[model samples]
Target: LNEIADHDDEGAALQWLRRNRRAKLWISPVTLAEVLEGAEDVDAVRAYLSRYGWQGIHRIQAETAARLQRRTKHRLGENDAWQAAVAECMKARVVGHDDAFKRLAAGYEDYRP
Candidate 1:
């Protein structure tokens, strides 16, 4: 949404997701924080996220993310690791342009538009 609001080309990913009726969109709570990090209207963003599927970080997911981070040789941010964990838990594909997810690409589909 931040990308879409800012008119980034990567915003096309969001468009593609919306157009794909067969796809189910999901986001981690960490992702919500990342999206709201620099937003001027936090309430609006919060409301927006509420409309989509939210994957909350639980003890299992936290542990999974930690294990994944420890096992991987590649460097990744905390939130990225959490998102990857969420993806693994949901057995769903990740849609984004972040290169940090390359390592997990084989486990889950990584869509960039």
Candidate 2:
């Protein structure tokens, strides 16, 4: 769920992401891109993940992409589509505060966290 703006941990956003990080986390390539892009230091990611290890970072693949694409509505906003693409790709319940992503998530009743 990380984004460029998420770098600013001035509020609840930071708490939400860090609170349950010990739990299994799913990530699509897009989400990976976001975290990498948002980070100020590359080594921090490696250092942070080193403890959790690769097994903790469950990467999503094409199955998620196709499923999300199939579930996505044609009328959805561009950002929403992208969001769906990533969430769907991971088959992970999205952790988004945005209205659009929330709405899209609503339609994915089968989505598992």
Candidate 3:
């Protein structure tokens, strides 16, 4: 979002996200944690969270994420696995450019922005 807000080179991803705003988007707790850890302002993070309206992680989601980690042919990090699980559970596409996500793109649609 900051990239989009600042009109950065990587703003294409944020633009895609905005275009799909009406879609039932779901962000994993792991993803949120990753973002918050790097964020300098708590208020900005809170505002972003409110804007996106993230779905909280439940036991079922966590279990499914764990299963995905164990079953994937690619070696995925904790955050990527959880993000993939959330996307799978929601039947949504994974919008990212990370190699880990790209590796899992075969199973999920890659919103190449």
How many clashes in each candidate?
0, 2, 0
Model 1 gets an lDDT of: 0.75
Task: Tell me the tens digit of each residue's lDDT in model 2 across 1-113.
Answer: 24323445544545665666664555444455566776776566545544431212233534444555576464455444555656554455556555555556453332113
Candidate 1, residues 18-49, lDDT tens digits: the string is: 67868777878787878888677778777767
Candidate-wise lDDT, in order: 0.75, 0.49, 0.67
lDDT for residue 12 in candidate 2, whole number 0-100: 55
In model 3, the worst 10-residue window by lDDT is: 1-10
Candidate 3 segments whose C-alpha is farther than 4 A from its true place: 2-10, 106-112
At residue 106, give the lDDT of candidate 2.
Answer: 50
Tens digits of lDDT, candidate 3, 33-83: 776676666567656666564766777778988887777676588777777
The full ranking of all candidates by lDDT, starting with the best, is: 1, 3, 2
User: Clash pairs of candidate 2?
Assistant: 64-88, 64-89
Output the number of the TM-score-best candidate: 1
By lDDT, the better pick of 1 and 2 is 1
Candidate 1 versus the native: TM-score? 0.81
TM-score of each: 0.81, 0.49, 0.72
